[model samples]
Target: MNSLVLFLLTVVAFGSCLKLPSSFKKCDRKTTDFNQCLSEAIYGALRILDKPLPSHGLPSLYGVEFPDVFTMGNSTYGLLQKFYQTRYIGLSKPENINAKLDFGPLTITLTIEATYSQLTVETEFEAQGTIVLLPVNVITPVVYTLVNPTYTFTFVLEEYEKGTTYFRVIDSKIDAQTQGLKFDYKGLFSNKVLNEEFNNAMDEKWRQIWILFKSFDEVLFAPLFGTIFNDFLKKVPAAELVDG
Candidate 1:
C-alpha cells in the first residue's frame, strides 16, 4: 500500500509540471516580431553611415551603413540606461561628458548632455592618446601618430521633440586635418567639402542613436516589463511553507 501511494503521488506531480503549448504561443510570436523590427531599424540607421559622402555640394551624398552592430548596440544600451536613471529612477543629477565614437580610420568624440529639458550633441576629433613609433633604435624612426582634436558643435532639441523629429546644424567648427584631408594624398583637398561631409556624418550618427532609443522604449521595454510585472503579481504566493 505504501509503495502504491508513492507511485500515485509521483505521477500526479509529473502531470502538474506539464504546461499547455498554447499558453505562451502569442507571447513568443510577439517577442519575435519585436526583435525583427528592432533589427531592421538598426540596420537602416547603420546603412546611412557605412560610406563617406562624395564631395559635391553642401550636404554631401553618402549612405550611413557600416560599423558593426556590436558597437552601435553598446551605444544604444548606454543611452537606455541613462534614460532610465535620469527619467525614471530620479537618481543622480544629469550632466555632460565626452562620449567617443570610433570608425576604422576616424574617431569622433563629443561632449553631450542629458537633462529634463533637452538633448545636446557635439563632436570633436580624438586627441589625447599615445603614438607608437616603429623600431626604437632605427636610424630614422617612423612614427604612427594618434591625434585627438577638440570640437564644439551643440544642437539642442526640446525634450518633447526628441523621438519624432529632426534638427539641422547651421554652424560647426572643423578641424584643420579633417578639412584638409578630403580626398586621397594626390587628389585635390577642398576644405569646404570636407567640413560639410564630416558634419553631415556626425549628424547622421546622432539621429541613428536617437532612433535606437525610441525602438528600445516602445517595443522592448514596454512589452517585456509589462508582462513581467503582471505575471509577478499573479504568481506571488500568499504564504510560506514550513519544513516538516
Candidate 2:
C-alpha cells in the first residue's frame, strides 16, 4: 500500500511539471524546423519577436558565483580609488532577448540587485599578535551585491553548432552600452551618503554579469530544441528544415 501511494504521488508531481505551455501551440505540424518552431514558441510567449536572426524572446536566467576569495593588492584598485571588500554579493533577474544587432549581437534588459563587499589588507606588523603585510597582502573577502535594478545588455554571438536544423551556442562577448557596471553597494557599505555618491557618480554603469544573463539564452536555445532535434535527426527520410 505504501509503495502504491508513493508511486501515485510521484506521478502527480511529475505530471504537473510536464505540463506544456500554451505557447507551444503555435508550433504546428507544418512548421519546417520543429526545433526552431519550439524555440520561437517558448520565447515568443515572453514577447513578440522583433528581428529575425537569433530569434528573439529567448529566456535569460543564470546565476554565477566565484568560488575563490579575493586577495588583490591595493595597487590593483588604485584606478578605482578604492580598497578590497569582504565577499562578493550579486544576483540577476531573468531577462528577455529583445533587441538584435546587425553585426550579429543581442541585448537584454535586466534588474541587477545590490551587493555586499568588504576589503581587508594584510600588514607586516602584528595587530593583537597577528602579522600583516600592509595592504599588499590583504585577505579581501569581497561582498558585492546588486539588488534588482534595471539594466540592458548588448552581446555578439561568438560560436554555435547544429546536429539538426536547430542551433546551439558556444560562447559570446559584450559590445557597447552603459559604462561598465557595478551592483548596488548601499547595503554593504552601510553608509547611505557614501553609497549615494557612488551610485550617482556611476549611474550609467553596467556589468559583464548582465551580459552573462543575456548570452545565457544561447545555452537554453539548443536544449529547448533537444527532443525535436533528435526526433528529426533520427527520423527516416532525413527531414528537410522547411518541411521536417
lDDT of 1 at 101: 20
Q: Which tens-of-lDDT digit does each residue in 170-204 have in candidate 1?
A: 22222211111111111112355753564455444
What does candidate 2's lDDT look like per residue over 1-244, in tens digits? 9999878876654443222234333443454464455444434533322211122222222222222232322444331122222221221222322332222344212111112222111212111111132232222222333333323332222222222222222333232222234444333234568546655554354464546533432343223323322332232111221232
lDDT on C-alpha atoms for all candidate structures: 0.25, 0.31
Model 1 lDDT, full chain set: 0.25
Candidate 1 positional error at 80, Å = 18
Number of the top-ranking candidate, with lDDT as the measure: 2
TM-score of each: 0.17, 0.30
- Give the runs in model 1 whose Cα sits over 4 Å from its true position: 1-205, 232-244
Clashes of 1: 13
Q: For model 1, where is the 10-residue window of minimal lDDT?
A: 137-146
